[model samples]
Target: MQNSTRKRQKEELNYLRDKVQSLEKELETKRHQLMASKGEDKENKAVRVQLRGSRARAMRWQRIAKHQLVEKQRAEMQNLQLKESLMDQIKLARSLQKLLKKNASKKVEGTEAAQLQARLEFGNYCSAASEDSLYESLLRDMDAVYAEVDTVCARHPVMQNMEEGSDVSSLLEGETDALSLEATNSKVVPFGMEETCAAVWRCLSKDHVKLADGTYHSVASSPDCIRAKAITTLRVNTTTARMQMRFAMKKYVEPGRVVITLESASESEGPRDLLHGLKMMQRAWVVIRPVPFEPEDNEFDGDLPSEETIIQLCMRLTPSVSATVLDIPGQRAGAITELLLAAVHRNLGWLFQTVENILMEHDFGATLL
Candidate 1:
């Protein structure tokens, strides 16, 4: 029994050793799995860190884009305000010019009227002169007056149709016949003739009669015939009277005309104001564009600015200069002022075109990008 029990114990010890070996194998497998899981966890943490960095970069870019948009909007608003201010200044200038024109008209009226009266007096003197030498001198003076009148009339818009070359002869001939007939039929009664004798003569003269084509006709000088014959023909009245008189006095008479001269600080001032105003408007347009690009800096942006904008800006500037002139007290009157203003405006238009071409080229490149 002792030998059997020892054999059984030995078997039990072998089984225990086997169990321990199996348990060691399981523990080794479980250890390897845990280490692999820890390695995977470490790799996951690295990938998450990379993702977070990428998201931060995206957020930064979005912020930059928003900031640029805000800046562009602010610039556009400022440009609009500047444009409105310029328009207001232009309006005020126009009002000043109107007031000046009214005042100038009133001041010049008396001077123009006095000049007309003096011309009339000179014409009377020429008419009264009887001597040939006096007549020749008067004729020369009259010619000068007529020349002045012609110049004044040329400046007038309404009387433009009454130019020097129009045919006055046709107008005069149309009224000549009536005047001649009147002269022929009118009898000059002796100034001292008694009223009783004149009445008897008229009655006796009226009784005369005549025959024509088998019909009895009045041969006596009837009142109707006398009256009809006494009236002057149109042709005679026009040619021998009014036209002849006009032709005779034309050399010594003044024609109706007036001269205009610009006088004011606005007119006398240089084109600097116009140039400045134009530049301001151009800059304003640039700022308001979707992309603010300076063509002057880089000649490749193809933004073509409208020519009408430049032209309108120049027109606005012109009246402003005129207004400045009106504001100036005791300004001289001369055509030079108007000529200068026109010259400046023309120069500015040329400049605008040149600048526009340059800006267009610049804006085109920027827009393409």
Candidate 2:
């Protein structure tokens, strides 16, 4: 009886030890599952925060794009309205010219009207073949014109004051703006640089030029000024094709200041595109100084903040009418000069468009009527 009782006690003790071990294993598994669930919750929170940030950026960009589109449309509408107004003014001028001619007793009035009419004429029309010599001549004497520009600035300019030691060459080495334009073509491959410079000088000098060897040569000067920031434009009867002009340009910039000089130089086929009543052998130098941009207190001032810019433009051009109907094959003309003028029109307009933009107003001073 004592042996049987001892055996039963030993079995009971072994069962209690096995039960304790199994309970400990189950408790450890529950702890591990709680830790994993916490880790997954943290990861999900980070993803939600990132999604909110991305959405805010997208909303900001959309607002900016919408604003820009509205501004562009408003600018285009203003341009169209101005064009129509100019056309009306031109028609009125034509009617006045006719009325003056018909009145037999108005001799003085008729003569004055004729001179004004001649001035209003788009350009000196001529055959493409004929203007070649003039274009070449203008190119040959281009630099002489700028030489006069230097002299004029030196001899107490009537309008703007010139700083000491200021010269065209100094303007050439201007600080560059790398971010404004992604790609640029500044190379003049067709004609040599020497000729273009010469033409510019000649364009400026309406008088006789003393050659390098001390001899004087005469140049018939058609000196004209183009203001890069002119608010007005000239009206012409020509079509859009006349807007094409071929030229080379060099630009320089500094803080609040810019200098742009361009000359008529062809890139392909030696300016053969001139056969179509387009401007050739053109040259211009423009200087712009930025002023404070501020808002005005008027109903007309809401298009944009009125930014004041002081601009000075010096230019020379000779336009010849084309008698030939032969079209230029893939002619890339008039964009650079046109866009350059338009961009700068705080003071000016085309080669045709710019011509219209800047050459509109005249007091008949030094202009041969």
Candidate 3:
């Protein structure tokens, strides 16, 4: 019995040793797993902190951008307000200066009017002395135009219609019909030379009749002839008489420059209104030239011609009404001259504006031959 009991105790002791070994192995695995879990937790915490830092930077930059935008808008508003203030001040200063100038010129303007009132005789508007002066001035203008045309023509393959300016001048000198042949106002419109010339020609040549009332009312016209380099016809009917008018145009080209010259088609013929013993004649050396592209900054206080076309109008009117029209006791010669000049100027303005409007509306293409 004693031996059997010793063997069983030995077996129990071996079983106990095996259980202790298995328990040690399990504890080692659990320790390794715990260390790995701590390492993973440390990595996860680092990732979370990095994400928060990035979000903070994003929010800061967004705020900075918004502030900058507000500041830029404020600056623009202030700049615009400053510009408006400056403009207002400039306008006020100009108004005051014009008022002062008008006040200063009033006296001289009165004296000038009085002197002009005593100029001519009973039945005549222009004196014989003015004829020589007018002829000379027109000749000068014609000479300038001829020289320009001849210069361009010499280089041209086809010699365009060549006429001597002197021939026209001599013919004009002999005509008893010229009431006044003088240089009139011109305009420099911002447009192409050829286009504007063509427009002007079209306006003059078309059988367009308009009746205007002013100094001498009821002037109606139907173009029976047009003589610009591009030829057509228009006949005029007025209260005073019937007018047979013709125009001629010539175009010349040079490097970067275009010139158009318009004059009477027939030297022997002039536009007239048949009032008893009054034969009205008009002679013109109107020129249209393109201005070179450049800045015109000359201190000479007037208008500067730098770009686009130069428009010179050569239409005028002679009073065929009774001599009593100017014989009113209170009538100043300045008033008569102003009235006549204003009428001519108004017509010219309307003509130009009409052409410009047509061009804009109809897309009027330039037709040059």
Which 10 successive residues of model 1 have the least lDDT summed?
280-289
lDDT of 3 by residue, 213-288 (tens): 2211112222322332111122122222222223333445556444445433111122222122222333343456
Candidate 2 residue spans exceeding 4 A from truth: 1-145, 150-244, 251-258, 265-279, 290-308, 321-369
**Model 2 lDDT tens row, 1-369:** 223222322332343344334434544554555466558657855754564356678678657756865775565555454443233223322322232223222233234333323323323321234435534533544455444444433332321432211111101101210001111111111222233323333333324322211222222333332111112121111212223232334444445444555554221112444223332334555554443443453457556443333344554332222222123342322222222222222122222222222222221332656
Per-residue error (Å), model 2, residue 255: 11
What order do you get sorting by lDDT, best first? Answer: 3, 2, 1
Tell me the RMSD of model 1 versus the true structure. Answer: 49.7
- Candidate number with greatest lDDT: 3
**What is the Å distance of residue 70 in model 3 from its true position?**
39
lDDT of 2: 0.33
Candidate 1 C-alpha lDDT tens digits along 265-320:
11121233221111000000000001122356346656663221101111111111
For candidate 1, give the lDDT of residue 358: 41
Model 1 residue 166 distance off true place after TM-score fit, in angstroms: 46
lDDT of each structure?
0.27, 0.33, 0.38
Error of 1 at 334 (Å): 27
